[model samples]
Target: MNKRFIKGTMAALVSMLATNAFAATEVTVYTAFESDILAKYKNAFEKTNPDIEINWVRDSTGIMTAKLLAEKNNPQAEVVWGLAGSSMALLKEEGILKTYSPKGLDELRSELNDPQSTQAWYGNDAFFNAICFNEIVAQQQNLPKPTSWEDLTKPVYKGHIAMPNPASSGTGYMQVSAWLQSMGDNQGWAYMKDLHSNIAHYTHSGSKPCVQAGMGEVAIGISMASRGAKLKTQGAPLDVITPAGIGWESEAVGIVKVSDAAKRVVDWSISKEANELYVEMYPVVGHKDVEASVANFPNVQQKMAKMDFARMGNERADVLKTWSDKFDGKSEAK
Candidate 1:
């Protein structure tokens, strides 16, 4: 072979490769998924669909919702992969989400997705609220382990409890909504008033409270059960406590109206394989066939509160406003 001919062929191949790389569909995804698992999810999706690539924009659920609303006029995200269902409902109300029923929609529990004639989003997995009690800190403070939600409000727990701020965290909002539904509106607010006195401070992210507790920064943290379980697995001297009735929220995915690539991403999101991956980290996945037994995590079926998710979504604005008026001033910095 002629050297010149070989060099020309190589140049042509390089140019073709560059063109193909540029032609690959890039989907911009917004998510409130935990930072530790974001890369794994992305890599798995890309591995299955090598023709499509994901560009993630991540933040806490509250922040992501506000940003999406802000960008209503000119949307930037192609899809929303891991945000609370309540947040997605709010986006649906704003007329931002594109209606899509993914391939495995029927396999999911009907209650997990939007029930309207035109579905706006589909659930992937659920996260439940739990108490993370640092064994070392509790022992040092001479505090007994709390087994119930009411137990945290006792005088002995005062100034030793850390919780997430509702205005900035989905887990916080779900807990507040669950309390109101389970305890009656009036009694729930009253309970919070008492609970507030015991709270040392409220953190910005749902996972932070548990992480702080695991580090012995606080004796107890009212946060996501998954975070507590993960911390405990990492050898944090913490006890993952699931109260009698626990607040929980589903994490869902939705497509924006813009871009053809969005549908491809949405389709992949609801696949059985995707649900299997979700269950590995979240346990409570949408697909009925998928089940996981994560260490230190409670059985969701036995512990989940009887929640009206739609009602909670509808009343979110009023609930957040009331909560902010009562407790926002007490929140610690992010």
Candidate 2:
């Protein structure tokens, strides 16, 4: 080839590369998914949809919810994946979510998707509150194994328990909501008041309490089943206890009312492939056909409380306010 022709070809190639890069859609996704699994989900999605890229903004559920609501006027997120259903419901009420039913919406369990005709969100997987009792730690502290939520308040367990702060953790909120629904509002608050006297301190993250328990920092952790299961598998000397009638929250996805890429992400999020990926980590997935049984994690559906999640979503602010007023000062120093 002539030197002039070679130079022209190189220039054209560079310009084409730039154009393609610009043409590839970049969707900003906000999520409260565990940091360890975020990259895996992103990679899995990108592998299938090579033309689109996901930019993840990850945090604890409460922080993610607050951030989305705060950015309501000028929304930045194109989609929300792995947020708690309660938070998604609140966002829907605030008019922050756009309705777009994913392709496999009918294939999902009826309770897993939004019931509205104009669906704003759909669940991917679920996680629920559980007690992580470290056998070694409990033995060391001369503590008995706690079998129920009521057992945690016993004097023998005083100052040997750690729990997440509801103000910050989705797991924490689930626990609180479950108690209220299961035990009635007045009794639940009374129970918490007694439990508060025995608590060592409340951590900000849901999984932290279980991690602390695994390391023998506390005898018991009021945390999630999946975290406790993972810790036990790693030889944490932990017992992952799924107490009966405990509250659980689905890790859900919703489209923000912005970006052309939002619908695409939402569609993929509820696909069979995505459901397969989600089940690898969570016991319950949106799709009824996808069944998961993580070792050391109990069958959550059998134990989950009959909660009115919509009511929980509506009452979230008030419940958190009541909890904060009662226990915020007792939280461990950050």
Candidate 3:
């Protein structure tokens, strides 16, 4: 009855579909954020920003850093989100990252922001190292659960501990960096040598060590406290132990010199909504008003060693090389 009208409507529909597809922005983000939470944040952000899409490129922190560095001239990522703050600082020093402050940057803790506002990278949350002890395994082997960094070096723990390699894992570098900062260089290097004897293997991913311990693959995992807590909550016979002073680092976000559409994601990165999501895994977040709601979250404020991101960034290459020379023998396949 109305063949011409029907044809016109079909054409209009196709044209509208094409317009919307072209209009929507696809932002590429390279991140070392945990695999489990990637879907959560992506879904949440897209829900709020219907026209902006997130395409995540995920890897361990150190690997992601190297990838970004390798792609310096022809950047593939529009934004670098959830990489280590020190790594972001390093990128800023390399002139790889652009300077664009997000809308809510002032609401975050000033210390978590780049000391120079021109760098334009900011932390979202802090994660600290802890001992993930498989109590069952420890009891089976008659080994004591370690409560301090020094305790892992005892003879009983030899070849029963798993560690993250600082060369490939952000958590690993943070732990190594913190030790050096807190214990003095001479003592820190000496301490690592002692602990090196006990390590069963070093993992590329920070969370793998704890998962290995939870599975009874290793008795102890030197990893993030939140990881230990997550494993225990899943009914693993694991004890999440936080020592008196542990190394810690913040996960940060920065915009690459790409499309202006990337700024929307960076803006949402520091928002209260995003900070709330961060607290789902981390107890410490950059936003002062956002309280952590994680069940049985460790008290890490007093335990964190004083960190200088600038120093950590400057010394990263040297520290990683030395650590690799000393401990890379135990590392698992990349």
In candidate 2, what are the lDDT values of residues 134-209, reduced to their tens digit? 9997887789888888889999999999999987777888899999999999999999999999999999898999
Model 1 bad stretches (over 4 Å): 1-22, 34-43, 115-117, 135-144, 215-217, 258-261, 310-314
lDDT, candidate 3, 1-334, per-residue tens: 5999999999999999999877868899999998999999999999999889999999987689899999999989999999888888888888888998788876998766788857569989888888888999999999987778899999999999998998877788888998999898999999999999888899998889999999999999988788888878889998888887687878899998656679999999999999999987678899999886666557777777888887898998899999999989999998
The deviation in Å at residue 277 for candidate 3 is 2.5
- List residue ranges in candidate 3 displaced over 4 A: 1-22, 117-119, 134-146, 155-160, 200-205, 215-219, 258-260, 330-334
Cα deviation at 192, candidate 2, in Å, is: 0.6
**Model 3 Cα shift for residue 30 (angstroms):** 3.0
lDDT of each: 0.87, 0.87, 0.87
lDDT of 1 by residue, 1-334 (tens): 9999999999999999999877768889999998999889889988888888899999977789889999999999989999888878888888889887777678886666776778989889887999999999999999999988899889999999988988777789899988999999999999999999999999888899999999999999999898999899989999999887788888899998656678878887888888988988778888888888888776657878877666777898899999999998779865
Weakest ten-residue segment in model 3 by summed lDDT:
292-301
TM-scores, all candidates, are 0.81, 0.85, 0.81
Model 2 pairs whose backbones collide: none
